[model samples]
Target: MNNPFNPSFGKVPNIFLDRAHAVTKLSTELQNPNSPYQTTLIYGVRGVGKTSLLTDVGNKMSAKKNWLVVNLTTNYNVLQTLIDSICQKSSPEIKRLLDKIEGIKLSAFGIQFEYRLQELTETNYQILLENILDKLQAKNISLLVTIDEVDPTPEIKNFISLYQLLIRENYQISLIMTGLPNKLSELQNDDVLTFLLRSARMELSNLDLLSIKHSYQDTFAKKGITISDDVLIAMVKKTKGYAYSFQLLGYLLWEIADKKITLATLEQIQGEYLATLGRNVYYKVLQELSPVDHSFVIAMAKAPTQVVTTAYLQQKLDKPKNYLSMYRKRLLDAQVIKSPARGMLEFTLPYFKEYILENLKFYV
Candidate 1:
């Protein structure tokens, strides 16, 4: 049984309803006459289709609104990349104007550099921005620039600064950015950006239970499979509505789609593979851990609720365990799990918890 929803894997067209709603709202905001937002920030956990929704919005807006879209994936030299992006689509007169300027012919990494007086100064950037924007406006072309990875650090700060300047100058440009939620707080604190970010914050939270259920049902229905409610609920509970987890499980379930899935067949997974699939993701991360760290995780797996205190880990590892402080840091660095507040941690990957518990049941 092929998955009906599998086509959407790693593709933008398969965006779910919940994510579509978010994109639609932003689109509506962009086209709104009364209170249009100049900049939009979309924040969500990894693999929640932030990029996909933006792609869908961009495609639709391109057709319906004739929007000129510029998408920038945050990478090295992002600021200059943005400058090049603007130049690529600048008006012929603007391009001709930039071309006549001296020291503008140089290309780095296969991109032509544009030389304009205001390109140098923060003050002048605004003056130059108004000129370019005026030209763009003359053509009745609105711009929607989507920048993924909203971290307000080095690479992004430059773009943010320029955009903030444009906003102050009242340029007619719409911006949509996606990144980790933590970065949103970072932007909210910036004096320059705070005023500009009045009401354009869109948070992409996890899918609700009903949405997840609907997604699975739709996927199975497309495959001509009738999944039982109990099996469907089990899958949802194990995945906890995490997008990537749902995809991975859905994908694997499809691999076994020869017949209708039953609890009995699910229980027949070879050896501990099924029990450990839930935990394998965690240990896949764990294999990268040091021996001491690995032992500590094994301890946590054996523990209830998958929670471990520093003292508990110390006792489990049989050393003073203060030496294992680096272990926690490394685990976090590896994104295995995170401490919610302090003194408590949960598996970042849900299936890992079940994997660990199953290991304890079989091996211990």
Candidate 2:
């Protein structure tokens, strides 16, 4: 039996995968002999297929061309680690290059090589990199380095500086990176990174409605499960084009089906079940908040509708009106709520909105 919960790393064929057009275009560009941007950055919101897309692209690039692809994800210190990982990937060549450089000691034992950058100045390091890049270029092997979750690392700034230097001096290596939505902003604030940002920005394609439907139908069909159009539409509506949510919903519904999902079972999913899911999700989000903010969240959750007014919440939470903005900023930083319109705030997690509404009394 095929696994419906494909949250794992490996790509599954015949599964409900989308983003073909975008992947194809990226493949073409990366493989292009004349392609300019040695480094590319792909950005999107979380669970929007960023990982899947990069995985697919990396697989394609590695299999077809002489591209040396390494995909690494980092939550912190990505730049130093990225350089270290890349140097590790190029270890054999690094050993060979260091061997050739006078007064440098290089030794390789088993799969590990120990060396000292102490004997080498920054200029020597740059020269060694250039020599390795030339050797790689000679072999027609472009180093495609991809780093995910790049924002948390301060080293990213340094890495970008080094990468821009390599590009300026014409290295054959290329980079593809993805991270939190605000990462680009962080990168752009620096002068060198601002220059690179303009040169190498590549946007990931979003899944369209048709792609969503096709993916749902295909995934279910593979499992011998079928869902009605109405149920499919509802799932799509709830997911709001989020790729992970779509996969999560599909996986959950497959379990709910227990055999074959039909129009009946689809419609049979009660609001209670949805509300329960929402509550669990919202509760987890609440766990991250302080006691006071949690109370403020409860007040907002107790409201009947999606739109929560500041005046009403202030009165309910017994906070002064002037403090609303402060509360709002705190929640915003915590990413609990987003202000869609002026004076109107909504939970970033829609399911949490439902969760809070039904479970507010318990928490309160």
Clashing pairs in 1: 278-351, 279-352, 279-355
Clashing pairs in 2: none
Model 2: per-residue lDDT, tens digit, 1-364?
Answer: 5556553333533344567776787788887646654566776545556667778888888786567777766545443344345445654754465345443344443222223546444455555556556767766668787776566355567666777787777676777777544566567666657775565565543356667787787777777776678767776776655455566566567667765666566556646446544443445556647788887787777787788988778778777877877878777654567777888887765366666666667676
Residue 189 alpha-carbon offset, candidate 1, angstroms: 2.6
lDDT of each candidate versus the true structure? 0.63, 0.63
Estimated TM-score per prediction? 0.68, 0.70
In model 1, the runs with Cα more than 4 Å from the true position are 1-3, 6-10, 13-17, 33-36, 87-111, 114-130, 196-199, 264-303, 306-349, 352-364
Model 1: per-residue Cα lDDT over 1-364, one tens digit each? 3343432433663426467677677777787634545577776655556777777777777675445677787676665555567667555555665544444442334335355645655444444455656656666667778877667776566677777666566666778887665566677677766753574777665567677777777777776767799988877776666665666566666667655766664555423434444443444454545666666667777666666676777776777655767777766644466787677766666666666565554433
lDDT score of residue 256 within candidate 2: 72
- Top-TM-score candidate index: 2
Question: Considering summed lDDT, which 10 consecutive residues are worst modelled in model 1?
Answer: 1-10
Q: How many clashes show up per model? A: 3, 0
Q: What is candidate 2's TM-score against the reference?
A: 0.70
